[model samples]
Target: MNHLRLFLLSIVVLTSANMLPAGDWPHWRGPNDLGAAEPGQSPPAEFSDTQNVLWKTPVPGRGHSSPTIIGDKVFLTTADVAAQTQSVLCFDRQTGKPVWSTIVNTGGLPREIHSHNTHATPTVACDAQQLFVVFNNHESAQLAALDLNGKILWKKQGPFSPEQYKFGYGPSPLLYDDLVIVAAEYEKGYIVALNKKNGDVAWKIDRPQISFSSPVVANIAGRDQMLISGLGKVCSFDPKSGKQLWAVDGPAIATCGTLVWQGDTVFASGGYPEKETMAVKADGSGKVLWRQGVRCYEQSLVAADGYVYAVSDDGIGYCWNAETGEEMWKKRLGGSVSSSPTLVGDLIYLFNERGKCFVFKTNPEKFELVAENQLGDEAYASPSFCDGKMFMRTADSTDGTRRETLYCIGE
Candidate 1:
């Protein structure tokens, strides 16, 4: 009888572990970049700077990169303007306390950046043991790998120093298997994959023009390929060999964020010459099944069920049919927005530049606004969802004071 009771207890433990909801937003656009979470879960209907926020932790310096959560820890990067320092910060997910900060002082290089840009504009990606961060200083573009406890494992610097736009490096790193891939589409356009363990060059492919978009991994037609978008084009490359598989040209402007893949279809959106959104068949041959011009800049598209949800840089939200490229609904909101929309169950969350967040229903037939909340600051960085909590960061103030902070919104 005792043995049977113990066996039953063990079974219950295993089942509970497997049944727990997957809420960890480990990367830029959450797990796998689909931006859709498991159904039946929803964030709080109303949250503000003072209410319903689980914790608000102060982050050093200013950066536009979003926060990535792994296990019980959250990781982000920032740049100290006057100090000319780039640092990666770790926070305790549960208590919102600072864990450790690893500063990389790349001296004299940040002077070349635009006044609005910073040394840290890219978010860090981490697996179990290592975190990958990208820093674009004035003279050097670098990617570094650090341990969870804040030890630098390896660092790699780029050869070319190109003039960045008003914003610095907005391309975040993507991690695959044992490699950290970087889209260094600057003066010398190259997509380089480094061995994640030791920072050795695994594969590098050169392109014609530099872009600000990050690379996305997709399994198309029974093979894995990295889909990257840049100035006037989108292409897929063999992830292992860095060989181009297919290319489609004519994107109006520079790509800003990562592409989202759904089934065999991928959605990409950006703004420079206005907003252009398209859905390409990920057949491993880079075929365009259907393309529609939905104007959005700097905002990544999120697909859920049968619809694609997007927010324009100017703060307009739209829902469209993912299959037919038909517009469903469009609504104007409070302020300008750049963070991607996140779908948690049937609710879609959108955050704007002035730190206002709007929640709406995910129904494809209509636009149902639910709640609008504010954080009392500016938010240029994207919001991340993990462990039933939403993490967001505010931009810095104009007085060179770091008013940026990380907020964990949850029950």
Candidate 2:
């Protein structure tokens, strides 16, 4: 396998995402950035709170960020809304116990975020020796690095408060080579790369216009490139040097899901103002193969083989021929969906907003429903997989009280 992942992440645009024997899910979209774990592991096809669950731990606070597993430790970011603080949480992967918690931001919480949004929304990313996390606290995006034991290594902030659209920050920090990259797309936004060692500015660029998508790095069209879609454009940049390789007019002006690619074609989807899904060639020729009206708002799409699969924001599942943008099949999985589809071998795991877990085959011929499992009544965050378990973040909002729990689901 490619040794490229001791860890891969976005907070997620994870093209920098997914992993193996390293057996860790240290990034958002996973080590491969494709929302798929390394193929050998067996995370249960049907699992619930008591069934197929090896362990479960109550998370201290709430955040939509996914779990990031590295070594024996699992990491997540949370914010105490009443306390106005944001912190990094560590958990024991074996017994589902609390390991340590480090407070990263104490105050400066934004006055108004969307009712559905939280102060801590980015997944923590690590590069072997250190753990890195991002939070939209005190009106700016703060990036912090901590040692494996929860000691703060360094913390840096980039201004990101927008005047009109303040939905709160969502992009996770992306790691490439020696730098950690972050995209804070407000009206006056930027994509900045910082030195992982001391959090210094390596290179920075202005991402005007405002888009909420995370930046992901992938090797497509024969070269390593960083990709993100928003601000009325689909763009590729040189990951090492921060140079614009190529950019084309986009599928829309605002997008939340990270871009996913297959073969030489890059796929990007929805956001505010307009909604559409598109496939663009990544050869710097800026050719757009096809465009569709399907929108996947807060969740990213997964591209595999020659086909792409997605669960639309409205609770519908879709399979499209990646090469031709042909709609092979789309099934209504029901309820709303905020979590992305996770591909484990030929089986794909999907979770709807109401906490419905759907497992299905990747056969493009039709919608193949394998199994359906239900967890908490509310699930907004995505799941992370490693070894033989699935780390699922779910919550119970019954009786109007919200409590979040992280469940380790396995065979």
Candidate 3:
């Protein structure tokens, strides 16, 4: 079905009991946004080089961005380091066949970035009518809207050039209402929203200081508020008007994970010069309830049933009391973690840097490890769960030639 017809149709007819309709992961943190997929999907938690693999397709180039699944098409952005090009790839959702690739930027790829960061690190966000992506090319942030057939409809440059830091961009495009928002958080940073139809600028705000976090819009404290951490604070913005709702200090000056919430309180954690995880009241009160010295950094937090769950960089899974900042449980999972956790009903799927996935339950009482699935030698992209299957971007090196593959896990 086309996006217009899907929008006109009743959501009751489209959505499942507790998930977005169509089981499409439209953006960075999936459809419902808090890194969770549609419940009741029992995609195999165990898979290897051969076991339980539905279809395996080779992906060109490299990126840390996760897969964005919409309809029968899966979308991702990749950059050829040698060619200095950034492009988007489309794959047939069922057969794992390459549909089309559109290069958004050629040449002028930033020279210096963290070894783990990429020119095409941001995940594409698609609406009913267009696909939106951002790339840090030409030493600035470029936003583009593409059609489903891999055609660039419009590309515009936003104000972003980190003279001091130069870490590259990490925030994925956030689709809210009719706007596709993008954040580039250097000292002369900006959070801008553009019209999804024609790529017209809607609203823009300046942010000082540098950070790598993504902007997330959630309905918390009884209303819709946009949350992003960094620039030395946990900040909230009105997604509609580009107004600052509130900001609280601490959670460090640099972060990568998007903000997650439980009830009226939202949790944020980060890495940089310091480490801290904080719970802030989201009712425009600028009140911070609790904080812990532990950090999640690149991995975002998932909270449910009055508890927040996170995996540390040193390979440990932890659950904390959501309201009281009490440590509930911690289990060492081994290896470093970078991928954010995705929750499917009671189960949360977490991937470490070594491409080992730890399947565990979302219980606050104790650490519950369900299964451990290993796929490749390295992985930084989080898995996208959709339609009873998993779209994972993994890589294995053979004789120093690293090959990336997009694997459809489970039957």
Candidate 4:
């Protein structure tokens, strides 16, 4: 009987391996939503425009949205400013050639956005069957589901004007089971969970304050909770019912990074209005473990090996003890970072606005630099890894050109 049990377990493991393979950045922050790469996939530690790069494809228009890879296809969103159109694009994962392009929305403006924000700023998400995209066109917002072949499955829109915020909208959709959840928080912001199969609204809630932070789902103890941080509150909701679970005071007037979870504790940081970081209990207790002045505005926090790592917007890197909130180490990485770090094995890959990719070891004892490489232009989006390749979206040109390009880097 024991021999038979082992045999069945081996079959299940083998079958699952063949189905998912070693790499697939199906979510904006990798499959696990923690920005960690799959095990045993050692992407190149250093690469430039002419180094280890497998392919470089030119993407039309401009956007800071990160690339999402699933199976053999890579998905991204972009906006053609002159034409007044926002689009969802899919490309062949291996060859970097355009597979298909579909426009999600066209024309609809009267709102001025931040110089750094774009209409196509949100990253796309994909489940097993369809790809999801979100866009806010000044007066309203729309969420659409597309088939793997680029056909629209269903699209839904709601009233959302970001003119009051001045920075525009930049949050992405979260795919939770059969629901595509989105948080559109500006003046009079709200959260919506849509039926993934038919684009129907499953649940909705109003947010008291405005923020740009994306929502994240974390399983604590034994229950799954959806966490949304911004509007000066750290709130958890029922992903299935859209019911509010609990709320705590978050320090930021505007936040762009999602909460990072470790054990039963969750960590959040705010950059605008205030530079603060807080670790709170996730059991709806509203208990604060520790709060500090360390601010990581744009980049998200990464927790590993009992330490939470962060790189501030202006280049200050930090490693804090996740439990005690004690500072482990800090160093200036030397460039502005709007992109979050991706953890692969023992190393963390951090991209700066100047196109420099900084690789370092994730250690609590000290700061150690591994390697630094350039993409030959500006890179505002985070890096995505699949199999053995690193996909990065960079500015069209280093000389201030307006186009955007997605580059695939590997051995």
**Winner by TM-score:** 2
Sorted by lDDT, highest first, which candidate order results? 2, 3, 4, 1
Report clashes for each candidate as comma-separated counts.
Answer: 7, 13, 1, 1
Alpha-carbon runs more than 4 Å astray in model 1: 1-23, 38-40, 112-117, 164-166, 284-286, 395-402
Worst ten-residue run, lDDT, model 1? Answer: 12-21
Task: State every prediction's TM-score relative to the real structure.
Answer: 0.89, 0.95, 0.94, 0.93
Q: List, residue by residue over 1-411, the lDDT tens digit for candidate 1.
A: 134433432342233211222545556665645665533445586998778899999888878878888778889898777777889999999988999999865465544554434567787787757788988764556889999899998888875456545345678888877788988776666888999888899998885455678787766666787887767776788888888887775454577767776667877876566457887877755567556676666767877766788887778888888888888998888687777787776688888877788988877888899998887567777778765677888754667764888998889
- Tens-digit lDDT string for candidate 3 (223-327): 778899987898989999899989999798899999988668999999887798889999988888899988888889987767899888888888888889899
Local distance difference test, each candidate: 0.74, 0.86, 0.85, 0.83
1 or 3: which has the higher TM-score? 3
lDDT of 2 by residue, 1-411 (tens): 122221232222333332232578878888777888775666789988789989999998789889999888999989998888899999998998999999998989988877767888888888768899998876789999999999999999989898888778888899888899999987788999999999999999998777778898988887999999999889999988889999998778889899998878999998778889999999999899999898888899987667899988998999999989999998998998988899876788889888889999888899999899999988888889888789999988887988999999987
2 or 4, greater by lDDT: 2
Model 4 per-residue lDDT tens digits across residues 1-411: 134433432342233311334467776677667777765568899899889989999998888899999888999998887899999999999999999999988898435888778888889888757888888874777899999899998888887776456677788889887889998887777999999999888999998566888898877745888997787878888888989889899768889997878778989998678889999999888999888897788779888777899998889899989989999899999988899999877789999988899999887899999999988568889999877789999874646665677899999
Q: What is the Å distance of residue 189 in model 2 from its true position?
A: 0.6
Among residues 3 or more apart in sequence or in different chains, the pairs in candidate 3 whose N, CA or C atoms overlap within 3 Å are 187-209
Alpha carbon lDDT at 49, candidate 1: 74
The predictions' CA RMSDs to the true structure, in order, are 6.3, 3.6, 4.5, 4.5
